[model samples]
Target: MRKNSSTTFVFIVLFLFAALIFVFRMQLVGISGMITNFSRPLQAGLFSVFNHPSNETNKKFQQVVDTLVSQAQMNQLKSDNNALRDQFATANIEPSQLLPSRIIGLPQFLPGISLPEQLILDQGTNQGVQKGMPVIIKNVLIGEITKVESATSLVTLISSPNFLFTAQTQNTNTLGIVKGEGADKVVLVNVELSDTLKIGDIVVTKGDKNLTGKGLPPGLVVGKISAINKSPSALYQSAAIQNPIDITKVSEVFIMLK
Candidate 1:
């Protein structure tokens, strides 16, 4: 009776093992698709419940990014518009609308050290630029067109040693020749000691009397009087001008060809 009981238990165990293997193989081969079909709705429902807040959070983050980008673009547009307005205000000729360009190279003239701070315009005669054209950066006088080419030109900076301009004192109404010193300094030549020229006086071009224009336009603000020195012989008084335009920052300019 004990042997019969043992045989019956072994048969039951063998049958259970065979059934387990069959179920596993069926799942691997064909039942996998069935299991996915049955579980998809459950998975989707669980995701909706758990991920709804996360999706909203992601949308908020994206909105923040979009706001930042829009602000940056608005700032850039405002800057560009301000620059354009300045160009229009300072420009002289209707056709000579102050166009923008990059400084590709430094001004090269024979026997002079060019100041890179003074801008060199990229467009030249090809862009209707001509000799005697007035070049200005941000409404300040820089230089005038000296050499013209099909695509390039040389601007004679007012700070050059040989540069000279006929400028009048804003306070004194006194006219003198403004000549560039070796450095960035300029001298008000032949000014009389009694002419009432003083330090901190503003200087501007005497357009009607100016000869060279010194790479500048008539009536443009040149600089202020920084210092006044007298001649030992009392023959003349020399004054130094403090230029307004920071040459180093000159990037783009407008050429006014009359």
Candidate 2:
């Protein structure tokens, strides 16, 4: 009976081992599908902690863009200031030529038939600007001051009706008085009917002390001789000049501070 018991114990031990193996295989198969449910959440939590940024990404991007925009604006302002400084240096040496100033008012691109063209500037007596100063546009003399305030001034064109300039004709080297002819034209008076005087003769300022403005710069452009009278010319006293500054389309002007 003891031998029979021993054999039965051995058989029970083998069956238990086989049953444990089968249960283990079944557990492994069951865990394969639910393994994702368990491991994926843990993996995602770790990734959030280690891989992703804790701060707002969009906000950071906006800050970077704003910084770049501000830098660009500052650069533009710096460039503008540098250009103005260079212009100032050039203007000071030749104060009679032009002084850099701002356009405070532009009454007309093309004002009207009744009203003459006019432009107001931010420079006046405050910045050494004085009456009769020739205002230049892009280095070309365009007009003269009509009025002045403490910090502002008005420029009237040489094409204006009441304008006059003493000019020296290049052909004859003779002096003449240039008076406006109301329609972008001027009269060069006291021109001798020499063989030198002809159509297309260039006219420039004679640079006399009295003919220049009281506080204005002289030797600026007056006009060009567009036509001349002949038929033995009846010994006329004047020649017609084509004014240079087109009064209808002036944008910027520099006031001379001589």
Candidate 3:
């Protein structure tokens, strides 16, 4: 009878232990889930820290790139300044008489099909730039200021249809009226038929003080004579001028301030 009683007691203890386990199962599962969720975020954070560059590293890299770009721009500006100084010296022009200007905009046209007839400069009336000021690259006349605002100016290129100036040949001193036919075609017309015309003659500004004042200085190179058209029945001859510098490629220029 005592042995049977002890077996009953063991069975009762086992039953109570199973009841406690069942009652606490949900709480145990919740604790385990909480621990797993906490560890997941920690693991992800560590992985990101190891796999990706830090914000400071990215910032430093960007700073290095910016410095390189700034240095390149500085070098380019220095080169341009040196070139302008050399050109001024060669042209016998005083640097003080020139207001260095940057080309901010180019005339819109189909590339390789059309030519530029105008340019926008960064200087305007605020910089003492005014209409009728001659724009040049060294001793080569490119255009003149036609309009000015407070901070910008409009330049009408020598190749514009409305552009007209007096020019003369360097070799023969033959005088003619320079006219623009658009599309980068400039012509020297009204030349007397008896005047000597050559294929390689250099054309320069005739420098009329009464007509344009200091706007178009004398001896400024306009272009070279590429072709001459003459007719026995015509009253005058015309010559095709080839500009030395491609106006489309010009980035910087000087405005005669005097």
Candidate 4:
């Protein structure tokens, strides 16, 4: 009977313990939810601090990149300006008379095959650029402004097939018509047979001005005569002219303002 009484006491203790646990289950769930809510923001803040590509970090990185880009652009502009100043001093041209322009585009062609016919300049009508204006580097005539836009211009190089200008030998004053034959080849054509032609003669522009005074200035070096073609049967003799500077390599030039 005593053993039976002891087993009944143990069962009572177990039942009371289960009843207490059931009564507190909802409170325990509420406490767990409160803890999760409180830690969520803290966890997120810590993660952001450790992460390399957070929103704040990205904004700072972008600001740094923008600053670098602006600095590089400013440096390039300064360099271009300095180069133009040097060129003006070397050419003995008044700064007010020449508009400095950067070559923004080059004619596309295969290397070692042909020469460029035209160059695209950064300055245009908005910068006082006009068509038929002479483009030069130092004292050498490179091309003329054939077309103009608001912010850009096209220069037809001296080696273009359509280029035509009157030129004279610097030493002898032997006059001939300068014509372009492509592939960086220029020819002094329509020369009289009696005019003295030499292989090493330097040709220069015989300046011509229109009523508006927009034209090439005299004494701009064109090129040196490479070979003389004097055919006895032909009425006029021609000579091949070689430019001292490679037009394709030119990065800057000046436009003579009218």
lDDT, each prediction = 0.61, 0.59, 0.74, 0.73
Candidate 4 has a TM-score of 0.61
Root-mean-square deviation of Cα positions for candidate 4 versus the true structure, in angstroms: 28.7
Per-residue lDDT tens digits for candidate 3, residues 116-151, read 788877776668998898998766788999987656
**110-144 in candidate 4: lDDT tens per residue?**
63355678877777666888899999866678899
Per-prediction CA RMSD (Å): 29.4, 35.9, 28.4, 28.7
> What tens-digit string does per-residue lDDT give for candidate 2 at 67-134?
53344344435545776988753212233446886554545334344335566666656677777777
Q: Per-residue alpha-carbon lDDT of model 1 for 139-192, expressed as tens digits?
A: 446677787555555677778777777777766667888887755666788776
RMSD of 2: 35.9
On lDDT, the leading prediction is: 3
Which candidate order results from sorting by TM-score in descending order? Answer: 3, 4, 1, 2
Candidate 1 wrong stretches, greater than 4 Å: 1-97, 107-119, 209-217
Candidate 4 stretches greater than 4 Å from native: 1-96, 111-113, 210-213
Instruction: Report residue 110 deviation for candidate 1 (angstroms).
Output: 17
Clashing pairs in 2: 230-233
- TM-score each candidate: 0.55, 0.53, 0.61, 0.61
Model 1, clash count? 3
Candidate 3 residue spans exceeding 4 A from truth? 1-96, 111-113, 211-215
Residue 106 lDDT, candidate 2, scale 0-100: 46
